[model samples]
Target: MRRNPLGRTGIEVSEFCLGTMTFGSQTPEDEAHAQMDRALEAGINFLDCAEMYPVNPVRAETVGLSEEIVGTWVARAGRRDAWVVATKHSGEGMRHVRGGAPITPDTIPVAVEGSLRRLKIDCIDLYQFHWPNRGSYHFRKNWRYDPSGQDRVETLAHMEDTLGALAREVERGTIRAFGLSNETAWGTAQWLRVAEAAGGPRAASIQNEYSLLARMADTDLAELCVNEDVGFLPFSPLAAGLLTGKYQGGAIPPGSRRSHVENLGGRITPRVFGAVAACHEVAGRFGLDPVQMALAWAARRPFVASAIFGATRLAQLEHALGAAEVVLSDELLAALDEVHRAHPMPY
Candidate 1:
């Protein structure tokens, strides 16, 4: 439950952030409340949700339900200030959010207003672009990612416009800071460069899939975070439960992410099993729970400010929060580095 600075915003957030994408889909409202209560009791003061969430199978009918659930908790408990609430503006496609249109300057106010109305909150702590309108290589698209045809001038215009709108929100007291998700290193740098040149708020964080199985952030993203003072909010520190070793040996427990996503969003290939086994062995050597070790490993990264983890049940959340105090030793960290060298880029 250590608190870390969120970029240079002067805001401190819990090292572990509670992700609420499951709030209105896989979990009920009462259960979501219980998870939130448990997290706060365990010293997790950061919560992340989105305008389009409950997304195991994101649909139009259930869109925004996650925020509504969080809104209910905020309204009933009157603890909006107790947590650092972060949410996103979905990029495009999916047809359910914003009619499949990309996030634009006009859409910023509209999206923020919807989130405000749904969450019953006046301002957001960290508002992020779910992805770049130009598209991203994240979510297993790296193999086929191609940005050669993208127009840099148009992209810069978009960044300037987006930052202008966000600066307006800052003036209006609707958003405190901005972040990026599923973005490339160059894309993020342009946003930061423009924000600084325009005297607007700099992009404070980048949310991407970073775990034992997916180490794409270790190369360029990590360097950017170190140089820019931008925080890394890893979305799946457990590799969607693969690092927990629960899905080892081709076993899929009922109600697990693997049960629904089968391959854990293209993360379940043959190469991943060895990495999972190695991590499990590492945890056993240290007498630590695999789940806690996985989370703590991600949280203790030099560039990571917070590790975002989701739980469908309260017990699952409790297991994740236990990682808050599980500090890794130099010996264990070296072992992890060796494992990474052996099984880099499983996805």
Candidate 2:
């Protein structure tokens, strides 16, 4: 329930953010609403969603269903202002939206308008680019992630032009802050530079995959966040449910994320289960729920402003909420760090 500053935007958000990517796919509308209600009641005031959500098996037909569900909840409750809503603009490679077009100056207004209309909100508190148009190393693409062919001049020009478009949205009161997702330190710096030069919305946060199983953000990106004042929002703090120990012992429970996406988005690996077991052992030593332990560990990072987590059921959400108060002891943190050192980059 602790609130932290969202970058330098003067906006305070809860340490934990409820992710709604499963709303219309793995979860139905009524259940999604119930989960939201439970999260809010548990002091989670930040909600994160994206235009390309409900994404276990992303399809054109259900592209915007997640946003619509959130909008319906807001309309029915008449409390649009109760939560700090953050959503994304699909960057590139999403065929369902704009025919797989990369985000550009011409597409900003169109995407923003679509999100606003679907969410039934006048303005998005935090508008984020889903990913860099140039591509990123996230989602298990690091093995072949090569930036050698990127054109610097063209990238900078594109950033400046995009910032200009975002500036207009800010002036029109359509967005309060801007952010990046699945981006790198260099990419984030360019966005910040462009925003400063154009007097556009400054980059307020960066959402990236961070978890016990994924530590890519613990290096350069961690330093960038600490120095630049851009809040670090770690998505999948539980490693797409890998760190929760449910997928341990090769048991893929019915209706689990693994059952839907067999590899959990390529997170499944020979070393992953062993790492999960190591984490579970540490939690057992401290008599802690592994789910809460994993979440708390991510939230307790030096540069993290909020840790985004998702749940398909209300019971799972209730378990994750306990992480808000489960402060890990220094000894426990060291143990977790040891495990990370042993199984670094398992996926």
Candidate 3:
């Protein structure tokens, strides 16, 4: 439960952040509350959520239910001061929210109000743009990602306008920090430049899919985070449960993420299971639980400020919590590197 600085925001959060994407869907309210309690007791202070969550089967009716559930917990727990809450504003392509509109300056205020009302909080500790208006390469979209058609002028203008609106929110005491999600190194650099020029809040963190299997952030993104003082918050650090060894040998447990979303957001591929097997072997050689080893590896990355992970059950949360104490040795780290070299980009 080591604490790391949240960019230059002067807020320190636990290295392990509790993710609430399954708050109302895969997990019920009472169970969600119990998970939160367990995470807090284990010294986790950061809670990550989103405006459109409970995402196993994201629906229009349950768009904001996750925030409402967290709000109820905050209301009853009466210890909001102890938690560093983070949530996101969905970007374009989500038809259920804002009529599937892109995140523009005009939409910032409305989105902030909706999130605040649902979270029952006057201010969000870290407010992130869920995805860029210009799409991202995350969720296994890198193979088809094309940024060549992007208009730089229009993109810069949009960044400035949105940053201005976020500045207004800062002045209004509605948000303390700003961040990005599913963004690239170039995108993050543009955001930093725009924020500097506009005198708005600098990007504090970047939440992207990062794990042993997904090492796209290991180069340019890692450099950007280190040099720019931006915290790297890795989402799906377990590779969407692939690293937990539960989906190996073609076994899809009942009610698991695979059962709901067959491919686990396009992460499933013919080669991924083989890679998972290699990682599992490394974990066994090191005498570590595969789940804890995967999480610990992500948390131990040099640029990572926090590794976000979610659980539908309390036992899963407890198992993940053990990662806080499982430190990978140099030998094991080298073995993992060898495995990565052999099976890089499994999906």
lDDT of each candidate versus the true structure:
0.91, 0.92, 0.94
The regions of model 3 sitting more than 4 angstroms off are none
Clashing pairs in 1: none
Task: Kindly list the per-residue Cα lDDT of model 2 for residues 1-347, writing each as its tens digit.
Answer: 79999999999999999999999999999999999888889889999999988798899999999999999999999889889999999977999999999999899999999888889999999999999999999888899999999999999988988888999999999999999999999999988887787667889999999999898888899999999999999999999899988898788999999998988999889999999999999999999999999998898898999999999988899888899879789999999999999999999
The regions of model 2 sitting more than 4 angstroms off are none
Query: C-alpha displacement of 199 in model 1, angstroms?
Result: 3.2
Q: lDDT per residue, candidate 3, 1-347, as tens digits? A: 79999999999999999999999999999999999899999999999999999798999999999999999998989988879999999989999998899999889999999999998888999999999998888887899988999999999999999999999999999999999999999999999999988879999999999999999999789999999999999999999999988898878899899999988888888999999999999999889899999999998898999999999999999989999999889999999999999999998
Worst 10 residues of 2 by lDDT: 192-201
Model 3: per-residue Cα lDDT at residue 21? 94
Clash pairs for candidate 2: none
lDDT of 1 at 133: 93
Candidate 1 segments whose C-alpha is farther than 4 A from its true place:
none
TM-score of every model? 0.98, 0.99, 0.99
lDDT of 1 by residue, 1-347 (tens): 68899999999988999999889888999999999999999999999999889887788999999999999999999988998999999877858998988988999999999999999999999999999999899999999999998999999999998899899999999999999999999998998999989767899999999987788999899999989999999998888888878888999999887777788788889888888998888889989999999899888899999999999999898778789889799999998888899988888
